[model samples]
Every structure is written in structure tokens, then in C-alpha cells.
Target: MIFFIILGAVFAAVFLLTLFFSMPAFQKNAPASSLGKLSFFDTKGKKHHPNPTFVERIVLPIFRKFLSIFRKFLPRNLVESVSKRLELAGIQDNVKVDVFLGIKFFMPFVFLLALFFISIFFKVPTTLKMILILLVPVSYIFPDYYLKSKTAKRQEGIRKSLPNALDLLTISVEAGLGFDMALYKVAENIKGTLGEEFKRVIKEMEIGLSRKEALRNLTKRTDVTDLNTFILSIIQADIFGISIGKVLRIQAGEMRIKRRQAAEEKGMKAPVKLVFPTILFLLPALMIIVVGPAILSIMDILKVMGQ
Candidate 1:
């Protein structure tokens, strides 16, 4: 009776808290900022777009409130770290640290509540109980792991695409286009991570940021060693009044060589990586196929002799 009463009180408190937070008093009103006007109606007063999805209509509002609630609790250092990770992951603008933290804190509560219900309604094993406990930390740490994975993949894409982008920039610059024009051409020609980053750099330049600062920010956001070297070379060229074409050609050559070396290194490791699958999966399958028929034939002969 006491346990039920306590559980009911906890649920009531949670429900009340969720309601309070979801109210307008706790939520900030921010005007939408977009490049163009967002109109929901057409000329005939018809809808121009589909209705919002479940997440957009319901989850986001709740999440915004939760975000506001959790925003104040983050430590300064942790916020900085989250900001850096989000920048590297290419989701800095889309997902703020407070929103991410709110999700992180909320998931464990959800997991706990779900487990509590399962424990009440059914028999939960000791292993499941252990897993329920483990889910708490996993809920918190999963975001970091996900963010790191995204950053790694984005960096790899940027690294692989850099040489090609540099080559294009070199070609355009040598053909008499100015540095900025050549950068524009490269961004327009390539359709990958490198292209998108270059487009961002261009936008930054347009927004009154100096070229050197924009390039530095590009390197910082990418966190790729090859790109950092390329940007450093450009910055040096700018400082020394060296010919942009000459600097681009040199950087492109170095990037091509580095890319080739990376390819060769991966080629060398391929056979070593294949060895594990051969022993664990292929070798066993071959042995089973060869030995099985012979064992079956021997068993048949033994049965016939016994008959």
C-alpha cells in the first residue's frame, strides 16, 4: 500500500513538472529567423506544405521547455566542450548543448520509469535489473559517443575530399581567376563535405569576416590535419604577398601525395584485416563441408553392419 502510494505521488509530481515546464511561462518566445519568408498558405488559402511530423509538432515543444530547464545547470567548461563537439559534428546550429543535456537527462528518467513499470507488472530478471542500472550512465554517455563518431566521419570525408578540392582551386587560379573566384568555383564544382565547408567560408567572408579568420575557422571546425596545413599555407601566402596560384599549386601537390600515401597505407592493412574473418568464418565453413559427408557415410556403414 505504501509503495503504491509513493509511486502514485512520484508520477503525479512528474506529470505536474512536465506540465509546468511545457507552459508558456517557462518557454521563451523567439521569432523565426530564415533567409526567406515562410508562408503556410497558397494563393487559394490551401496548405503549401504537409503538416508537422509527430516529433516536430509534439516532441520539439516539450524538448524546448526541457532545454530551457536544463540550460542553467550546465557547467561553463562542459558547455564549451559540448559546443566544440557540436561544431565538429556539423550540428552546432541545429542542436545546442542545453537541448542535448535535456535529452540526456530525460532519457534516463524514461528508462527508469519504464523499468519501474516492468518490475511491477512482470518478473524482471537480475540481469535485466543490472541493465536498468547500466542504462542510467549509458543514457548520459551515449550522446558523447554519437557526437565523436559524427566528428570522426565528417573529418574523414573532409580529408579525403581536400586534395580534389585543392586541385580544382589550383586549376581555376592558374587560369587567371582571383583567389576568391577560384574558391567559389571549387565550392560550386564539388558536391561533398569539402564543397559545403568552402561554401560556409564564402558565407563567412560575405558576413564581414576577413578571409584569414574565415579560413582559420574552417580549419578549426574541420579539425583535420591536412586542411590545417593547407589553410596555414594560404595564410602564409597572404602574409608574404606570394602568388596565390603558386601557393595553391604547391598545396595541391602535397595533398595529392599525402592522399596517395593514405590509400597505400590502407591497402597494406587490408590483408591483415581479412585474416580474422578467414579463420573465424571461412575456414570453419570449409572444414565442415569437407568432413560432414565422410562422417555420414561411415555412420551409414556401421548401421548396415549392425543390421
Candidate 2:
């Protein structure tokens, strides 16, 4: 009976997979949406479009399937909110909102199913069961939390790296490089979230986006205050007939000053941040070490007096 059941399961799984793959949608030339995303540029100044990988083919499809089932039940506002969050997280290219919602919708069932199987097989304690049950909600929330963290980190990276990148751009411009070439050089040299964003901007400019539009798009994508300030400054310089080098030079100095001030602010806040940990964990341990023996000795004396 076990052998037959295992064989039937395997056959059923294979049949489903085969049917899904054999569908004309999957067999036909991959959709433009699934292919040809802007990744980088080559020597000939052409945008390199990347093909979808394994995650897109397998994992995303599974989530997309779940999304389709529950699409009608989801609110339009909630979907738009999720889309904005994904865009901010800088994963708009790799993961669609539908696939993300599918994951969110499916995760609770996954957690409950795991718990069900574990309870069936193992002798589970009540506390553990409660924790596992709580985790179902957490699992549903984890993706959104992860995206928020990712967006925060990306913006922080841009903030930290902006000063140095600006300095390099200023130097390149001062040395007779055009703004586009200088920007491209800086993007190629400094690698990080900032560099990748600059590269994307450069690519955008190459593909018929005006410099202002490209810079504005960059500001939109990053949402970094300092970056937005720099973009606005550049745009204004273009409008008022200011030299690019002087603008770059001024922005570089300001960026460096702002970064220094930010560092000093964090340094000033460090003591305040440490105070809570010192009180909560270290102070109790220290009090036990210092006053514990004294309390013990006083107790002994009291016992002697009583005797």
C-alpha cells in the first residue's frame, strides 16, 4: 500500500508539472514582460536586457498561481500599497506585486501545514505549539518587513556613498570630462547601491530620457534627501546657466560637510543609546556583584543576634 501510494504521488506530481510546462503560454516565445529587462550597458552603448532566471520560472510561478486564486479578494488600495513598497525596495524588476502577494497569501498555509505535520509526527509541547501558531502571522508579515529593511538599507547606502561619488564626479568634470562621461566614470568606479543607481540613470539618459528626467527618476527611485538635494541643484544649475563643474564642486563640499555632521550626530547619540543596555543588563549584574555579599553578611549577623 505504501509503495502504491508513493508511486501514485510521484506520477501525479510529474503529470501536473508536465501539463503546466506543456501549456502554450510556457512553450511559446517568452513574453516581453518576462524578458528584456534593463541590467547594464555594453561598449557599444546598448542596454543589456537580462533573461528571467530559475526563480522567475519556478518560484515566482508558484506564487503567481496562488495570487490568481486570491486576486478578487484583495483590495485595490492594498495592492497599490504593496506595489509602492516593492518599488521602494529596489526589487521591482525581479519580483512583481502579484508574485509578492501570492507569497504573502501562501505563507500562512505553509506555516500551518508544517505545524500540522510536526504535531502528527512529534510529541509537541503546548508552548511550542503556541509559538508555532504565532509564527503563522509573523510569516505572513515577514516579507513586508524584509522589504522595508531593504529599502532603508538601500537609502542609507546612497546617503553614505553620495559624498565620495560626488567628489569623484567633481574631479572628473574639472579635468575636462563631460557630465555624462564623468557620471559614468564614477558609477563604474564606486560599486554599491549608489553606483548601481547611477548606472541606471546613465542608461536612462542614453535611451532618450533628458538629463532632468533621468535625475528626477533617480531621486524618485532612491528617495534619499541628500540625493534629491543634489539632483535639484543640478537641475537648477541647468536652468540658470551655471557651470556644471562649479555645481559639482559646491555639492561635493556640502555633501562632505553633511556626512561629517551626520557622523558627529551619531557619535553624540552613542552614549544615549548605550545607556539603556547599561541599565537593563549591566547594572543588575554589577549590583549583584557589589551588594550581594553585603546582604548575605547582614543576614548572617541577624541570625546570630536571634540565636
TM-score of each: 0.78, 0.72
Candidate 2 lDDT by residue in tens digits, 213-307: 99998887778899999999999999999999999999999998998999999999999999999999999999999999999999999999999
Off by over 4 Å in 1: 1-59, 113-123, 304-307
Q: All candidates' lDDT scores?
A: 0.72, 0.73
Pull out the clashing pairs in model 1: none
Per-residue lDDT of 11 in model 1: 66
Question: Which candidate has the highest TM-score of all?
Answer: 1
How do the residues 1-307 of candidate 1 rate in per-residue lDDT, one tens digit apiece? 4356335535643553454334321232111111112223213353344786665588667767768667767787877777787777665443456666665667677667756776787665778667767876886677677668767877888888889999999999889999998899998898766777787787678767999999998887789998998899899999999988888888999998998898999999999999999999999899889998999999999999999
lDDT assessment of candidate 2: 0.73
